[model samples]
Target: MTNILIADDDIHVLNLIDIHLTEQGYKVFKAYNGIEALEILNKELCSLAVVDVMMPFMDGYTLTKEIRNLFNIPVILLTAKNQIEDKERGFHAGTDDYLVKPFEPKELSFRIKALLRRYDNNPDEYIVRIGNTIINKKSYEVKVGKRTILLPLKEFELLYFLMSKPMQVFSRDHLIDQIWGLDYEGDERTVDVHIKRLRERFSKLTDHFQIKTVRGVGYSLEVNRE
Candidate 1:
């Protein structure tokens, strides 16, 4: 379940991408604009993203540039503008790859797989190990030591986001936005609830607890130095 985000203003484009990517066995998240894309990007750590150049409020260039600064995630631009200057501009904006409009879905999928293999931390699988816990980001599975722990869908999602960037502080507001999304009518308390659950479960198994409370700041994963 490799996560992939597709940001396009056209409804048809979004539908097409969602259908094709999902059929190809990739977890595809779709957004109609850059703002929506940014919101989703904050929540899930995707292996790659396919973004349209022309979008309202932020556009592909600005969104991709911001994403690059935040995470070393790969971005592929889909643009009607196929000019050399446009491609150069996209590269300047930190785009890893680009595809002009009116392309095959299979080609896009192949390009995405190639980029992930070349750039992602785990090309074969999207898993991150912390302490003795194994996180399969694709399937949203969590295994502590040799035993597997079943987390509720939302809780599993929350834990994955927190673990993606170990030791990086995330404010309650930020966590809420990321886990719940901008449209979710949930408050900051939701973050606390999930954090409490995650800690309790992890504390029972591994001596090395990863989630850390930064007091007023919020929560972060504790990096084991030894």
Candidate 2:
């Protein structure tokens, strides 16, 4: 079983997340504060850590930095503040994912799963398969059955990224930064255009998966697992 560590000051929030994660078959190690959290970490090899920004003795950012320097595991920072600066700081602190307070437990579960998959996979080489669709990073081709489809460079990169995380939603800004360079000066709608092209190309060609827009959020590739 995969072990996860959840560190937070609030007992209610920690227990709530623990119950949900335990129900999902994860062995959870919980702590009421950052100091206690590190104590648990020293003994247990957790697959991932869910940490709250506010904590006694040490904060989430500091704990995240310690984890990054000491262990090779994914970290998700939870904070009540949804401001851009806070998010930037979290990212700078080496968090693999971020969640605002009052978030749905189900959403946190999904983020955890996605980050696990991401960290487990080799960044430079790996093939992602969902349903009948296969994204081959080595060849830069998407194979749907026997028919091999080659997408445009950006389109292919975009498809590969979305397929990589499967059901996880990625905002337009995040997508742009990953697929394109941080120095990319183009409009954010570049992501939209690529998504549209990928959808149009694959819609009639396969029933394996879909690039779904999440309205206010962004997009996720929903796999037809059944």
lDDT of all predictions: 0.81, 0.85
Residue 70, candidate 1: Cα error in Å is: 0.6
Question: Model 1, 22-104: lDDT tens per residue?
Answer: 99899989999988887786567677889899999879998887666545578999999779999999999999999998999
Return the TM-score for each candidate structure: 0.58, 0.54
For model 1, where is the 10-residue window of minimal lDDT?
A: 120-129
Tell me the deviation in Å of residue 140 in model 1: 26
Candidate 2 lDDT for residue 215:
96
Which candidate should be chosen as best, given lDDT against the real structure?
2
Off by over 4 Å in 1: 121-226
TM-score for candidate 1? 0.58
Residue-level error in angstroms, candidate 1, position 208: 27
